[model samples]
Target chain A: MSGVADDTAVVVDQVSKKFRLFHERNQTLKSAVMRRRRIVADDFWAVRNVSFEVPQGETFGLIGRNGSSKSTLLKTLARIYVPDEGRVVMNGRVSSMLEVGSGFHPELSGRENIFLNGSILGLTRKQVTARFDEIVDFSGVETFIDQPVKNYSSGMYVRLGVAVAVHTDPDILIVDEILSVGDGAFIEKSRKKFLEFTGQGRTIILVSHSLPQVREMCHQVAWLDGGRLRAVGPTDEVVAAYGASIEAESS
Target chain B: MAASYARELIATRELLLNLTMREVKGQYRRTALGQLWSIINPLATMLVYTLVFAFIFRAEPPPGDPSGLDLYPLWLMCGLLPWMYVTRVITGGVASITNNAGLITKVYFPRMHLPLSVALSTGITFGVELGVLTIALWIFGGFPLPWLPLVVQAMGVLAMFATGIAMLLAILNVHFRDTQHFVSILLPMWMFLTPIIYPISLVEDAAARAGEWILQVYQLNPMLHIVEVFRALLYDNRLPGAVESLAAIGSASVVFAVGYLVFSRHERRLAELL
Candidate 1:
């Protein structure tokens, strides 16, 4: 593994992720054999030769319209998708809250899911146990912690999931517009937690459609268009360039 | 590569343990009989086999050689329980990657842990079933308590073998969804091919009449030796034949190695594929 500078938090070097666009899924023996091959699809590069770097303690935003593949790039950084080209090097431990409840088992209780979700985010049982009370209290679902998450309201469920995810204590946090979870007060509380995250000099890689959120929270921003990096700079400049492009297109 | 994979596997031990616990708990969350179903399922199948092979067909195989006990259901269970565990692990493992697509696509961990944890959870259920069967063997004066250690060892080897096959097919199933369905239809054929319902003596007899090559081809089936190992330890209260146990370990290691190599080759693409 190549080492990055201590001042650099993340380096995305010429990363590209290819996806298969299947015409007809060849998911049966009959189809596979009759076709005389595994299913073949058109090669589509979702993230194309995108390169950027994040300095330590910088809250970076990936801003793009729908279908720009910013989310794919984030997934690549999170190790969910191995880049077909180039590499991503991170200097610190990373955790991604990609979705509100990515790893929750509906049949398990809220308490059990806290441990399970925490484990999925790379926290050990002992680490999760250490913050068990804080996670539960943050979620405000202590009344129903023992009940299966299937029975909890969607809001309650998302709160518990978010609670477990944010508490994993990663040096670099990845998010996909899941920060504003639950009702008004919980959202405010979680926002404060994220503020504290940046105050602690942690880096965050955020992919969001909300330009205001990006401008408000991000120090640096990378604008993506059609799976390519359009512009990258301080938050205001990139956000303005992205906004003008959207306006030009809508007109 | 293998060293790093093994090291990461060790580092993620807690995740593996929790995944196994989730599998075991999720399996019986709302069931009426709960964990007893693991035992009852085998017993029911044993009763059916005992009736069909021992009663209706009037097949009277030789008793356990040294233990000197002869009961149709108990003898049938000695092999049947292990076979059932094989079926459960394979079926569960082949779908481990595809079934957990939500988790796989969203979060990242060591992907191999999915199938391994499934195999381990199946091993837990198999352990319970084997414990009950061993106790029942004792009740019938089979005296397998002395061989309990060997039973655990046999289970571990069989689980490895099953997990290997599972991991290999799981990648296939992701590419060709029909693999699961195809394996389901083939399982009964596999069970019949093994010596669970009938003794290996019958196979030997057929081989004698047909050709020596017949038995040689039959022995190529690893499950036949696996079943024999269990029957030797739990049913006969003796060590498995030297060659038979060696074959079991050899095939298990080969399969596990192949499975790991193939799975690692394809594991990264699984998120995109799924």
Candidate 2:
């Protein structure tokens, strides 16, 4: 695993996000006119005053139990969710493999989806063309490359999705539970790609429930609990603290 | 802030192009006739409307055409070609963000691109429709060469106006699902009011007895100016009057500016709302 460098790539400073929960699903004008108004159930904070920094060219991991806001934090970093308070500052092009095949159209061929998904992930057509063979090679879906993606097996679909995402070559990659899917061989292949990604001196912010995986890949880790950052330090220390807290809670 | 947004949009032009391609290709995919439907759909609409109005209602074609062409169908198509673009933009644009809730929530991109690409895709289909119109002109009106530029200019204005409305509705639909339902109801009403099937002269004749305000408001319809420009170029072989051209371009610019403003303002909350 690589150690943290001095330069900062991503900084989340006092960021927070609030979600509105309505008493009724009142997003339609008909209901609003009929009822004459809306009733608010509550406004809940999804992430609150959470702050962290990932150094340039290092892997940062976020490990948390479910509902701990790890995914929200990762999304905030990806710029998918705008923070309700404070801000996230970043110095490089960010691509979130938040969900693979995000913009894929089932009617489009795999060859076409590769171009579409590549651009959706922020690559230009020329860039996609240059890396076309490698992407096909990585996905191992070459025989069906020209077929519409609807015909691809589920396993083939995900592998192609992952293959395109990693090829985006972003300065900062935000990954959320992507590795947990796919067959064992594909998972191993994806890990090798991540290693190659880190080898190129890029930053990665990983959100996963896999503590040991985090401990192995990331130099620094932050543990989130109930929408707050509970621990941040070297990976082993934070992961160990999170593990102990889990044991204590169960006992 | 809007300038910077425009700059970013331009910088990400590749994404825009690719997405537009996706829209155009995805639209015809899985259908048997495929891309031919683009031309056939409008041609069929033109034939049906021409049958009803020209044959049944006996609406007069333009007064001075020696080409032996039945002027009503040509005139109707001249107006209908751009109308297709306008309606598609409004309905497609309104649903653009909502339909792509999957992508909007999962990934971060300029939300404006969805409506823009949708507008542009329809614009591409509109191009094919124009080709059909040009062929119709060759057979029916003998293909006036000098008047072609005017037709192209009117098409550009229509595109700008439609894209603007699309951008505004796309974001609005995300916040209120009622927008989707409202837009469908609004489009046919909008089409009837715009004078695509009938000539403005009929409305003017009605205005003399009803009141001048009737014609004044009818003239104020931005699409009225666009359809008039199309009729002027393709049917009458002339340029749109200065006032007509000004009205069409000016109204289109205003709509585009307002739509861009509304879309960018609401873009941040889109993922959350979706």
Q: What share of the true interface contacts does each candidate keep?
A: 0.87, 0.85
Q: What tens-digit string does per-residue lDDT give for candidate 1 at B1-274?
A: 7778889889988899889989989889999999888878887888888889999976666788799989988888898989998999899999999999999999989989999999999888888888888889989989999899988999989988999999999999998888899999999999999888988888899999999999999989999999989999998999999999999999999999899999988888888888
User: Which one wins on DockQ?
Assistant: 1
Candidate 2 lDDT over A117-217, as tens digits, reads 99889899999999999999999999999999999998899999999999999999999999998998999999888888788889899998888788788
Against the unseen true structure, what C-alpha lDDT does each candidate score?
Answer: 0.89, 0.86
Lowest lDDT block of 10, candidate 1 chain B: B57-66
Q: Which CAPRI category fits model 2? A: high
Q: Model 1: which residue pairs collide?
A: none
Once fitted onto the true fold, the runs of candidate 1 whose alpha carbons sit more than 4 angstroms away are A1-3, A38-40
Q: After superposition, how far is residue A125 of candidate 2 from its true place, in Å?
A: 1.3
Q: Indicate the residue-level lDDT of A156 in model 1.
A: 93
Highest lDDT scorer: 1
